[model samples]
Target: MSGQGTEPEAMKIVLVGHMGAGKTTAVKALGGVDVDELIESREQRTVAEIFAADGEGAFRDLEERVTLELLADPSVQAVALGGGALASRRTRAALTAARVVWLDVDADEAWRRVARSPTRPLARDERRFRALHAERQEQYAQAADAIVPASHVRRLAAPIAALEGMPAGAKLIWAVTASADYPAYIGAGLITDRRFWPATIAGRRVLVSDRNAASHYGALFEPVLTAVRIAPGEQSKTLTQAEVIWREMARTGVTRTDVTVALGGGVVGDLAGFCAATYQRGMPVVQVPTTLVAQVDSAYGGKTGVDIPEGKNYVGSFHQPAAVIADTTTLGTLPPAELAAGYAEVVKTGLIAGGWLWRRIAAGAAPDDPDVIAGCALTKLRIVAQDELDTGVRQLLNVGHTVAHAVETVTGYARYRHGEAVALGLLAELRLAGADALRQQVLELLEQAGLPVTLAADVDVEQVLLATTRDKKRVGEGPVPFALCIEPGRALTGQPVAPAELRAAIMELVG
Candidate 1:
């Protein structure tokens, strides 16, 4: 069974963007596929002719009915939605099950393509054209699962191909950014496949892992410079452990041209990636995350760091990886407790994403499902691409980490796993934001996943508060920027809450 059970549902690749965004061309580029063009499907008249004969509102009603009818078919594989089709609430709601790809184009470029087309009803009026384009851009972004620039249209075929007939053990997603771009592969036995391994990282590789992980899959690397193993636990994510690895790299003559591969969980990835970022003024790093937490949340993003006694992830740098290979096969070796702890991060991700992903998770989907893992990874990658340095929109990714990090710090990183702390943090933060309905839904999901929903009895509210003061998000003595969930799929960040309210929420969780 491939997680969702039986064969996967045929994914409908719905391309959505403004007029002249190349949605139809991109669909045709993926050869041997059926493309459903909404305008062409109308029997009596074209959409433009309908607008001329009747009116804009009448055209929209006909468009909505036709689009909904087409989307209802299980066999429909590809669709290019009209520019304003997704503006309808029913159309946007219906798109939650399909794969939406936004073909992003600049204003000038988009206008140039459609300026001479009389058949385009909205393009006839210059000012209205620009306004409608701008309005639909926001809607397209909100509804899209992936955003591909028009220039990168050729690269869309690879992921589209993967979705069409995805092999039993292969899953692929592309991570695009202004400075860096890479492919993330999640499969059952990908580490052993030389085809997936980049040739550039074949030599002088520094494999950073822990003793436990090394014991299982250390020999997978071909030409390793050295295998530096640290003690297993969050305690090992320290400056001292990083120094040991740095010394090992120096001893083994690791250089800037060489590559570093992190082969363990989040601890190994964060620690080794930090070294890769600082060593020789930065070196390429390839992440092969072996744990569920690393696979879903920590491994892909460029955020690398080590913990100090002051707070977690206090010292870190933004160094995006050259590539990421997530092998779901390795998950079988994890203990049940470790697996359940990792599921907490999955639940947190689903809450933040809150579309098809949340729907699947809420329906009791398995945590180890490859589609679930791929969806979470893609969500994080998209957020990271927008804000690599956590300056603006990236803060929404820390929905549960504020109180979670404090819990990890106050407990000395021993009592509960990272995801467990995050689970509790999510509840408290939801309470602070007053999202009662979503809070109850998320709480039930967390409980179903066998995750903790409250703090331990011995936890001190004052200590957690003091630790929050030292959080990296704290700025200029103001209250820390807390990410609060207004509802599923919508989160508000940088909200300042009173200490009394914070303390009361924490107390409520414990009591």
Candidate 2:
């Protein structure tokens, strides 16, 4: 609230996450105060000892009181909050007036770090500790003004230092993967904010944009040595277009240090990123995603490619970007159909995330909210960090994309938008999962969002079914590996659905 409109004011930037997230260490690394240390120094006892003597309820009361005191103090710039501090509603509400950064840590990593430590009182039980980590992630993500991986924090100080200077209401999501890591800046006016641009783009830039995005937003980026403008739409996202972009980069004397600015929707992001991935054996890319679908899903993952006749994204590479700047203001100019299409990914993400984000979508949160976009981005970031190549847990992020890609393939990529096909595909996958109630709920939500819950008139059900067998995720001679949502917040990959059931699900989409 302090930096939203009027002149800047003092507001505490608090770091929070599960136990073993290294909050105290991160605070020290950033030169910020640690409230837990302050509390321990006053009590003359460790936090574990205090918890043992006073119990969690009593400890929380003191934590809430002192945390508020620290946040209210004008001199305190930032503080590392206790892991359970956000469990208090009043303290969570107090964060509204503060800048909160969620220092992210996976449950396994947290457990591994704190398991044998005598100082972690509540971390004695592995089962309960993991459950609590899952439970608290929803809170941290919901309250965070920015989300940063715990692995990146000591180094994160540089980016966090730029947090307050971002456009009002802006949010940051530090995306980490096995290949590379980058910062995702989501806000109202990030495109023109030169100060918010990553240092990776400080040198010359070779932009890859579509006709629409170039005419609309291309001129805003300064000192771009050259640009390769291609036709808009998925139809143009092909190796042919990628070759066009490669030629232009070669002609412009582009080199490894120059950045590729992907300035458009998923089409441009995928094609340009593919070109950059191969050009000079991997140059850095800065994804300036201007569409809802791209901002929420494609821009951050580094899975860049073009569609071929065989299947969607059949030829691709794992080329992570140097940065992703999603200026939400661009969403305001999108057509109604594009926004509705984008909402499908939001629903798919919420279903996969299944806790705070699902509740928000069920309650009808708008797709354009920076928090919603950042939530979807963070969910994928967490998945990619663990399984960048989609060889394992990363498949969960494809809960609805398997059939969606098939739909796009059989329909020749023209009958439905990527998100629209995904909306229908979600219903199909839920039907396959036999989650009748959840499927109905998602159906109603998609219908409300103006998405097509049924197959298009020209789509061939049998062809769509055959296309699924050709799915890029398939290996050997088996059926396409399916990722299913058993319930909110839980998903499993590599499931086999019988042919009869697959037909039923696809047929259901027809009606």
lDDT of 2 by residue, 413-509 (tens): 7788889989988999998888999999999999999999988667889999998878878999987899999888888899999989999999988
- Judged by whole-model lDDT over C-alpha atoms, candidate 1 comes out at 0.77
Best by TM-score: 2
**Residue pairs with backbone atoms closer than 3 Å in model 1 (clashes):** none
- Span of ten consecutive residues with least summed lDDT in model 1: 1-10
RMSD versus native structure for model 1 = 7.4
Name the top lDDT candidate: 2
lDDT of 1 by residue, 319-365 (tens): 88887888887888877778888888898787777676777788888
